[model samples]
Target: MQDMKIADLPVHDRAIDITGETCPMTFVRTRLALDSLPDGAVLLVRLKGADPRANVPRAAADQGHDLLDMFDLDDGSAILVIRKAGA
Candidate 1:
């Protein structure tokens, strides 16, 4: 899908908060959340720090998921919307 505003993205199927997590663990938790969903499921992940913001989406995409939308909140944390592959 073409890049769209976060507000324009579909409602998420699941959500997770990883603002307290770091690096590999950030993606690990995200991966676990994705694994629990059916293909094409949408997951919203709230994360902090530049590492997770930079890594999680790339990792999810590497694993065949689609990065639907991502945006930073006013509080400085960010959200990542991922769509599981296979739809």
Candidate 2:
């Protein structure tokens, strides 16, 4: 099948892989990754399973980043596009 990835959705500054993890863990990993990025940079988080779909965007919003977009793939994965807020 075609790779339905976050990159295929829209332009972003960076892409992060968190495919093998679950809920809170997925959120945690995304949070840590965002820390290293400069404000205004976009992060494309790729994760497999359900929790990432529900939780990642919520976590991103809680952390002050804008949840730019989200894509649910046919292969049972999700892509969340988030933009870090300026400090």
Tens-digit lDDT track for model 1 on 1-87? 234465764598988999999899999999999999999989999899989999998899899999988877777888888999999
Q: What is the C-alpha local distance difference test score of each model?
A: 0.88, 0.81
Which structure among the candidates has the greatest TM-score? 1
How many clashes in each candidate?
0, 0
TM accuracy, model 2: 0.83
List model 2 lDDT by residue over 1-87, tens digit each: 266544456787788889988778898999998998999988889888766787788778887899887777777776788899994
Give me the displacement of residue 13 in model 2, in angstroms.
1.6
RMSD of 2: 2.3
What TM-score, to 2 decimals, does candidate 1 have?
A: 0.87
TM-scores of the models, in the order given? 0.87, 0.83
